[model samples]
Target: MNAPMAVESARSVATRFADCRDRRIAYRELGSGEPLILCLRFRGVLDSWDPAFLDSLAKSFRVITFDYSGLGQSTGEPSYRSEALARDAIDLADALGIEKFAIAGWSLGGLAAQVVACLIPDRITHAVLIGAAPPGKVENPSEPIFLERALKPINDLEDETILFFEPASPESRAAAAASRKRIEERSADRSPAVAPEIYLKLLQDRAAEDAFPDIDGYAEFLANAGIPILVITGDHEIVFPAPNWFALNRVWKSLHLLVLPQMGHGPQHEVPEMAAEFIASFVRHRSKSQPA
Candidate 1:
């Protein structure tokens, strides 16, 4: 009898494309549609996207996923400015011949998305933020809790996984274990120019730096930009809590919120169906009413 096939969980497919001046950036593309949704993760590589999450979203829209330079397959060791990352996202859209689309980002990518929207508001139709904070600025969590995460040492996979979730359930634990195994296997095969020290420095800078030029006061930008914005956070999320969403709610015109009961930083990965539904609903509502 033939052996059973291995369950392939990493739905991330690899591709290298020119960002600007023919600079190569590694990315993954799935599904197909108008108003494509681009996903930008925190500090994780393209493969870090949960397969189930991608599979679910792929069923609905053409999703574009990519690794920020210096962290994944992209070739770079130089410290990048947030503006450069934002520019890269715009360049990516240009490369794909997409005029305007929806954008979703988490953590650092969330900060980058804000910059992208501000830089080229004409090119982004809708925006969503999940467990995200302004660069060098965070809300919801008390100062002490924020400091704790900033100081936590992400030396190993186990420690890092815990930060992504809160009160980890059995399913989440199993997913973490499976993902760790895949990361270990993949890391053994290829290495990038990521500087662990640089990553650590970024965490410190994000915590200590009192000002971020591009995204310091995101509420003001959101209120002025006049775009449909959806801010979501897990009720149990430790990174950015529901109050942060509430904080932003005070400043924007067409802002909405979705608070999940038992999700975490990566809601799209931890609770994909819920996230996808919320996103699709947001897009549908906005597209029908607005002409962006």
Candidate 2:
């Protein structure tokens, strides 16, 4: 008998493309069942995701990861704003004939997730925000060193350690190294790293130092929209602090917050299985908060 030819996982999955809104969006999907679209963080591409995280999520949800229009492996007139990114997700869904599904985003992509959930709450089953920020003013904003490092043409292991992991904790730093290895394990057909010029312009033009810009009216939708939201964050989040979520406790009708200890912005990468379990359990049980 012949051995399995391909592993149904991120490491060896082929990149697929879909035409949407005059652009070709590059994406990859694995597993089966409920559709769950994942939005990448700033400077994040398909390869940027931790394979362990993707594999774990794949077990339950048909996790879809894609590049924004005109970024990474996608093609079309490029855009860097949150709404543009959200539109990309919506377009991809339409192209794939996926009417309703769950949406998850990290970092800047979190903002895009919020936009999609709010714009079409009827189409979203659940909104998952991982290391994502809330709408409105940023309370805990980012540190200068973050932007300084982000502006670099290329990031090294040390930069990855500081950017995503909690440096003060040995365990977190060690996890960061392992995550980096898993991400790079994909040797062939990897999505290109987002160029500094493109992602940098987003920081300079729209976002301020260490803070994600606010989109007007999103707060009200979050406050009243019957969407169940699960926000996962690390205890020591430098990019968008965990406390920011606390500032709005009970303010959001259906909110479940999970703060992992000794973790940073990339909690999913730090403990992929643990984070994936939380997501799987959350999505499986329907909340009464859904709009009827």
Model 1 C-alpha lDDT per residue in residues 229-252, reported as the tens digit of each score: 777776666665567556656656
Q: How good is model 1 by TM-score?
A: 0.78
Q: What is the TM-score of each candidate against the true structure?
A: 0.78, 0.95
Q: What are the RMSD figures for all models against the true structure? A: 4.5, 1.9
RMSD in Å for candidate 1, one decimal? Answer: 4.5
Off by over 4 Å in 2: 1-6, 207-216, 288-292
CA displacement after TM-score superposition, residue 198 of candidate 2 (Å): 2.0
1-292 per-residue lDDT for model 2 (tens digits) = 9887765889999999998968899999999989999998988888899999999999999999999888889998666678888999999999999999999999988888999998888899899999888987776877787877777898898898888888898988899999999988999998888777777676576655334455567887787787889999989888888999996778888888999998888999999999999999999995637443
Who wins the TM-score comparison?
2
Q: Model 2, 212: alpha-carbon shift in Å?
A: 4.4
In order, what lDDT does every prediction score?
Answer: 0.62, 0.87
